[model samples]
Target: MRKEIFSKKIMDWYQANHRNLPWRKTTEPYKIWLSEIILQQTRVAQGLPYYERFVGAFPDVLDLAKAPVQKVLRLWQGLGYYTRARNLHRCAKLVVRDFEGHFPNSFEGLKKLPGIGPYTAAAIASIAFREPVGVVDGNVFRVLARIFGIDKDIASDAGKKYFFSLANELLDEAHPDIFNQAVMEFGALHCLPKNPKCDGCTFSKQCEANQKDLQSLLPVKHKKLKIRTRYFYYFIVRDKNKMLLKQRNGKDIWQGLYDFYLIETSRRKKTAEVVKTDAILTKASILKESRVFRHLLSHQKLLVKFVELKLHSTKEMNLLARRSELKKFTKPEISNLPKPILIDRYLKANP
Candidate 1:
């Protein structure tokens, strides 16, 4: 039944309706690999322009391998999940140094590269090389769970193993890319998170979830996320035209973006107290005023306080090497410098 279902309906629907993305036009393993990595945790519209910019800047593996890590981070600045950028840089260098500037063709070889996990490796192998391997992701999980009426929690280890096995069994041997894309496209377009369009769906006739009237309840997820709240006090210290800024260093969010001198508090602090704290006033002679702002992430809530200080001496703010060069520098540029979402807001407000 699965084989028949694939041979007739899904494949035909995919060929007719799949979106013509730029990545689909090429068989170049490097290009395909780059697209896959960029699209991770990024939407098609947002990722598409970055993909074009990256390909234009570094057309080949060797070009990316040789480019500075800071430049790569700058290109990837707004995308969020900065680890993807770091991994991409590392993987490119690996390909050039170890694989002769060519992306590994086989699944095993592809998996050896940094950040090439199971799904990514499968995608590169099947989409670029046409290898007979299944690419199972969230979209696939939703489609398969509803189609087969599997109630196991997708977040569980056992459930993941079961789905991968089923995906492997159902993958079409003749055209793995088309088959994989078809199921994923169906899930993305029709079988959505809310108010799914099930009436005219190709699989409606045979879909077990539809027959049982459980369209929204089949794919169970068990993971619960704990959001942590953080307090940030950023010094917008300026002497005449120059403001103080520094490159963030350490293993935390916004690993390679530029930010002002920061003071993290245990909880939200009052405005008068925020300005009076030793961390805030030690570097500046006078504080004109302070502005309070808040920024939110998927798992974080940040309360930011911006202290606008007119410094006694610009040299005290050591992060700014040359005070005269402040106007020449552009705000919010994507570089290896650490950029939290709050920094972006500050740039937009100040720019």
Candidate 2:
């Protein structure tokens, strides 16, 4: 009876005032999956266009699977977290190859796919497949914690277990899709992370945090992110019309994306010191060195320098060819190469 009342009030509120988003109109798993992936860690306003662009570029799963990884990365350039784009591409191929282009129907099957964690699986399952599981994103976490006055640290394993059980119990079994949307939308629109509208909320009388005046203290976060800084010296190796770029490989950030011949260091090195001591830079004449351009990521801060260099002889080109990472490209091909947004900014400014 309590769950039914809560769901009734939420569904009423939703009908009166839910934002008409593009994804809300579709039940197709492909579109729903794309929206969920794109909106991960991204605000709706920022991610909206990217979703539209992706849908426009790759109309279906097969199109995404067939499209070049570079094209996908290029489309995903400004959006940080290249790993998501890679997984999106990989999942598309998997769906075509393994599932015969159909998304898995069961929650257990959906969770097995790469990048389809609990929240995403629940989201796609409920919105696209009408599964009864609850979706507990940051917004949902805030709403649930405040309503129930749950002070368990959301960053902990125990808190997740508690909330997952609570969320499932609170779900409206009859209309789980509508129930899930209402709760998530309620969190987004009314029960915000900070300064939520508890006074005007319909659940105010039933809300434990409101009755106890512990709204801000309910959703506890114990973890602190350690943001490290990295110094990257990038060489814009120019042989007149041609330039050099390297595909980022290995397990580092921005893997599979194109980058300049980079020399990472523990600390910032002086331009004169690098020019005089570095083996490759000594052979090339330094055309110019740019000021420090800072690119901020969630976990790391990149202090980057774009060092423009010119080759003295055809013999000097052999040194660059010896490098496995370095590959020469004409101006047109360089434009086609999918690079990190940090490198893209330098190219645009220099061009």
Which residue pairs clash in candidate 1?
A: 74-334, 74-335, 256-336, 256-337, 256-338, 257-337, 257-338, 257-339, 258-337, 258-338
All candidates: TM-score: 0.66, 0.66
Over the stretch 196-282, how does candidate 1's per-residue lDDT look in tens digits?
Answer: 788988888788888898888979888688889998887676655555676665887777667776778888877557657664255
Q: Distance from true position, residue 83, model 1, in Å?
A: 1.0
CA displacement after TM-score superposition, residue 308 of candidate 2 (Å):
34
User: Whole-model lDDT, candidate 1?
Assistant: 0.80
Best by lDDT: 2
Q: Clashing residue pairs, candidate 2?
A: none
Q: How many residue pairs clash in each candidate?
A: 10, 0
User: How far out, in Å, is residue 323 in model 2?
Assistant: 42
